[model samples]
Target: MTIKIITPEYVVFEGQVDSILLPGKQGEFQIFKNHAAIVSALVNGQVKIYTDSVPEKYSKYFTKENEAKSAYSFAIRSGVLEFNNDKGIILAE
Candidate 1:
């Protein structure tokens, strides 16, 4: 499924992903392909995206030594994730 992660500043990520593990307010939730439509709040934790399409040049974009790790996680504080039909959208604050 395609997943889009966005922040107020800019779009963080947009691409195909195998699955997503999100930090839900009640508890952790996992989203797969063709998930039912819904919307929920996010908590302070890691958002894990499982994918295999890593770009080589991305390693040079970050000041940290592990810029490649950005392909999987975004430590979100408070936000919302919406899923509908075949699309998944995450809006982080």
Candidate 2:
């Protein structure tokens, strides 16, 4: 599946990723392949993406500060999340 994180300045991160653990408005949640279409309010927190490959251009955006076994993550002040099919997009401010 694909995940794209965009801010008003630019596309923060864009690439094919294995998963996204988002900071939902109510609570945190994870999105994976074949996830049902859904939309959710996101709060200020980290967005963790798990993948073996991160495009060269976006590689700089994936931080290791919060890195896990095979995941890279970054934070957003606030945002909205949308997911469907095998794609997930985040509009972060």
Candidate 3:
């Protein structure tokens, strides 16, 4: 699935991802390919993006989760998430 993490000033991250773990208002949730469509409010927490390779340009925006760098994370104070048709968009603060 494709994911984009955006803020008022700029796009924090944008690229194809294998999956993502989001901090939903109710709790945490994971999204993968062909997952059901969803729209939810997010809380202050980390957003984990999992991919085999990180794009060089956007790599600076995320902190590598492991030495191999197959996973990365971005923290937010709050945000909203919407996913559909194999794509996810996050409007974050």
lDDT winner: 3
The regions of model 3 sitting more than 4 angstroms off are 67-69
Q: After superposition, how far is residue 7 of candidate 3 from its true place, in Å?
A: 0.8
After superposition, which runs of candidate 2 have C-alpha atoms over 4 Å from their true positions?
65-67
Question: lDDT per residue, candidate 1, 1-93, as tens digits?
Answer: 888888898777787888888999899999988888889999998887777753443322213224444346667888999999778999997
Worst 10 residues of 2 by lDDT: 61-70
lDDT of 3: 0.90
Tens-place lDDT digits, model 3, residues 1-93: 899999998888898999999998889999999999999999999999989867788778789887446889999999999999999999999
Worst 10 residues of 3 by lDDT: 60-69
lDDT tens string, model 2, 32-68? 8999999898999998888876777877777854446
Question: TM-score of each candidate?
Answer: 0.80, 0.90, 0.92
Which pairs of residues clash in candidate 1, taking residues 3 or more apart in a chain or in different chains?
none
